[model samples]
Each structure stands twice: as C-alpha cells, then as structure tokens.
Target: MNKNIDNFVPAEEPSKDQPITVLMIEAVGKCNAICGYCPRGQGLLGPETNTYITMDLLDKALDLASSGSNHAIYLHHRGEPFLHPKLDEIIRRVREKGFYTFLSTNLISATPDKVKKVLTAGINQIEMHYSAGLTRLPHEVLLKRIHEIRKLNWELRNFGCRLEMNFSLFGETREIIMEELSRHTYYDETLYVRWFEPHDWPSLEKIIDRGVDYRDCHWYKHKACAILSNGDIVICCLDQFSHSCRTNIKDIDRIDWESLADRRMCQGCTQHVEMNWLEEDAIDMPLWLTRKQEIDTWTA
Candidate 1:
C-alpha cells in the first residue's frame, strides 16, 4: 500500500529466445499441520527444525528474478509465507523491485491483528487454502471456522489485495460444493474461488512417475524456479528434496537456474509447460495455520 500496488498490467509474454523468470522463494521451512498430500507430511521433505529465509538470501533471490525483463515473486511454496519472521520485509522488498507479489496461507492463524499487519505490507494478491475434510473438524465447526476467517475479508478488500480461497483438490462435485461453501463468505465482494487441481500436491512420487522429458516442462522452457528455505535453487516447486538443486542463492552468479538439466533428479520429470509454471494462478494453502511461533515475533 505504500507504493504502486495497484493497476498492474499483466506482464508481457516472453519470447522463446528469452524467457522471463518467476521466482518462488520458500520463506519458511516448517508447517503446522500435516496433510496427506504434502511431502512434508509424508516425511520425504521439510527441514528437521523450523528454518526461514534470511534477509541476505532474500536480496539474492530478488536479484536473480529481477535479471529478466518482467517477473513476479511468490512468497510461498510448500510452507506458509507467514511462517517466516521477515514475511512483511520479503513482500515489501519484492514490491519495491516492482514484481507482482503474492502470499498464501490456510488462515487458521489469520487473526485480525496479523491480517492487518500483512495486508498493509505491500502484497498485491493473497490466496487462502480451504479443505473441509482435512481439518477433521465437524461440518458445523468448519463452517464456523470459515465464517470467522471470512470476517477479515473486509480488511483484505480495504487494502485491495486480491483474495481467493483455493479448494484443496478437484472433484466432480466442486460446483455444488463451492456453491454451498460460497454462502458462508458471501459478505465480501473481493472473494473469488478456485478448484485446486490434483497435481498441485507436493508429491515427489507422482511427479516422478508421470513426468516425461524435463525439456518439455514449463520450468525448463520458461525458467520457473524455486529457492528452498536454505537458499538452494531447485528446478521447480515440486523439487522439495533439492534433488535437482545445483547452486545456492548465497553464491548466485549466473541466472541459469536450469543449467543442470542432465541431473538424475530430472529423469522423467513433469511436462507441465504452462502458466502454472511461471505464475501460480491458484496457490495451494496448508490445512492448519496456528503454530507455536506467533506472528508478533516476526518483527522487522
């Protein structure tokens, strides 16, 4: 809100000769709740302890993405962006560099105070995750929970942040389900809904099994990349294990994040060459939000 956070034109499409890079900086290394889909829950990914991206590493991330003509920076990947102590700093810095910035959270921890702090911190768009079954709460309880969360939608609207609720998975009954769910949050006009596709899950097995040649993927063609919480640059968001990671952002010299296509981790990788690679239209949110690390501790 302090700078030009509104009236952003969609970035010009990059040519085949030169592709624009959309960077996803994994702000936090830990999550509160464990869902079945994420590799973090399956014990395949995530750090042994809670870790966060440092300010020094964040500057390096901006420099890497700003090397291109026009780009965006998403302050999330597997963990909640709010988990990072410097989340506001991260979003504010990305906005300062004129990148379309975003944040995603389950909103389980999004209290009024925390919501106001983040919405005023220069975020252009924000997405919240919604999945009823994962919470293990009764239907009525879940409804009440969403009702409380949606109350803060007014604040989000006040700051002009595009707020969308992402359903965890796609299903035949999505139309009817979303319609019924929409009734709870009908108070705000800024709210939009998106059906999260199945493949959006952070599973190394599924990606490896169905993956075709790595060259055909959007990450290879469009230069879409992710820097893990530890500053290691991987091929894409799904590379949570850093299997395809080559260079760390601390020593970032070259912009070619996909320079190591021949890595064994890329064998039979995903063929997803589309906008989902460059910009996540629908960001997936975690099931649980409130953790031991409170938002007040995340000071500048």
Candidate 2:
C-alpha cells in the first residue's frame, strides 16, 4: 500500500484547538447516477455537476488535523470519488496520516479487482449505495455486481474493515425496495438504508416496514459532516443548502469550532441538535429572493 507522502497535504493546527473524531470530506463532488431522487442535481452545480477537491487542498486539510483527532474520513458527497484520477493518491495520503478512511461508491463502477486494490490501500471502510434499480444497468448485471461485493470477505472481515450499503429513497416500487434489501441477506456484510427526504410519501413507513433502523445517517446521528473541495465545511451533507461556506483547512482553524457547529443556514435533523437560536432564525428565513423579473427569483 503505497505510503509515499509525495502528494500529502500538510497538516495544520487543529480546527478547534483539538483533533475532531470524524472528518467527512467531499473529495469527489458529484455522482455517476442520475437517480430521480438525487437532491443535489448532478451536472447542475460544478464540473458537469461533479467538482473535485484537488490534491493540494486535501493536503492542506491533512496538515490541519491536530494530533488528537483519530477521526475517520469519508470520501463521498456530491459525486463518485472512485472516478477521481488521484483517488488512490488521496487514499494513500489519508492513511499515511494515520486516519481511518472510508470511500462510499455507488457500486456501479466497483469491480471485485478494484475493490481488492482499495482494500490493500489501507481504507478502513468501503461503503456502497447500490443504485441498481435506479440505474440503467440491466437487473441481472446489477445483481451480479452486488453479489460480487457481498462475497468480498477479503476486504471486509479479513481486513477488520466495515462494508455498508446505502439504499437511496426514491419513488421505486415496493417490490424493488424489498428485492434490494433482501440482497443484503445474501451477503456477509452490513447495510444502511438512507432516505432521500422525510415527507417523500411514506418513506419513513417503508424504512420501518423493512425493519431497518431509522436513525438518520448524516443528520440525526450528527455523525456526518461535509468538507468541500475548497474546504467549505457544513454540519450535515444535506444541510449544505442552509449555510455552506467556501472554507479551507486554514479557515477551519480560524473559526470557533463550536460556534461553527451552530449552523445558521438550515436546522439539521431534529434528532441531533435541539432547535437552537440559529436554527430558529433559519427556519424563519425567506423561501425566495427576487433579483429581477426574469432571473433573480430563488425557489425552495
């Protein structure tokens, strides 16, 4: 597992005077799938709607983590990181810094051989959100790939690594959802089903019906955070619309860690932070802003 630090981002002062437990980085900014439920429309934001956090900026983030943080870094958000040219390098750098790293893929591009390569590269976890039903791939091919990853004991159990599945909540038929969930039973791995939106028509019920725990993965648990390619940090990946900033590792050190956590853009999942002063204000914020009769209006 290449340990060369040639592309390593230098470490800096801890963001909050100490090392944080978890640092979720959106190294790859978009996705390969055009799932109907994708909240952040692909190709609409940056770089074909898939912007990447450059190697230089990532090195800056590594330099910023204090000696105290043993946090695991997740390479996801916005896009498919496996498609990044320097993905292997990014993984190498993070592991070299002694950080437990995770790369969540859509499982569409993941081949068993590719999975083995990443496993050997010191990835602490390899998670996938299988979009078989939502993608254009034929059902047989998609199922085969899912089975392939599920059988990868070499990457999961043998390496003491974690493998998780993220089932995106879309307007899929009930039969499809059940079929996808059942695939987990066929594999020797764990699964995590995440909802696209709460009020998206009995989604909570579907999760409940599946007997899947409804703990909000990114929001409710407060277990998730996003660092943009430019180093902009936000509370939860989904809360980007509320109060996201274009920050860097240096910028993280400049702000009050706790104060920064006081997200003013959108109130994160209710199960996490109690409705605070900032969240309340955000809730009252305008739904739209009018700039010109034709192009300035913003809609939720």
TM-score (all chains, Cα) for each model:
0.72, 0.62
Could you give candidate 2's per-residue lDDT for residues 1-300 as a string of tens digits?
A: 112334333222223334333356777766677654454432234354356878887877666543323345677765677777777678878878766567778776777776655655656566666653347555455556667765664434352445555565555664667666556535323445543332222121111223322142323233234566656665554443324333445455533344234332232233333323122212122222111112311111
Q: Report model 2's TM-score to 2 decimal places.
A: 0.62
What tens digits encode model 1's per-residue C-alpha lDDT throughout 122-224?
A: 5656676756234433334444544554555444434245566677664547767656655653334254667765454454543253545555565656656
Residue 210 of model 2: what lDDT? 33
In order, what lDDT does every prediction score?
0.57, 0.50
- The local distance difference test score of model 2 is 0.50
TM-score for predicted model 1 compared with the true structure:
0.72
Q: Any idea what lDDT model 1 has?
A: 0.57
Q: Which stretches of candidate 1 lie over 4 Å from their true place?
A: 1-22, 132-159, 170-172, 179-190, 200-211, 257-266, 270-300
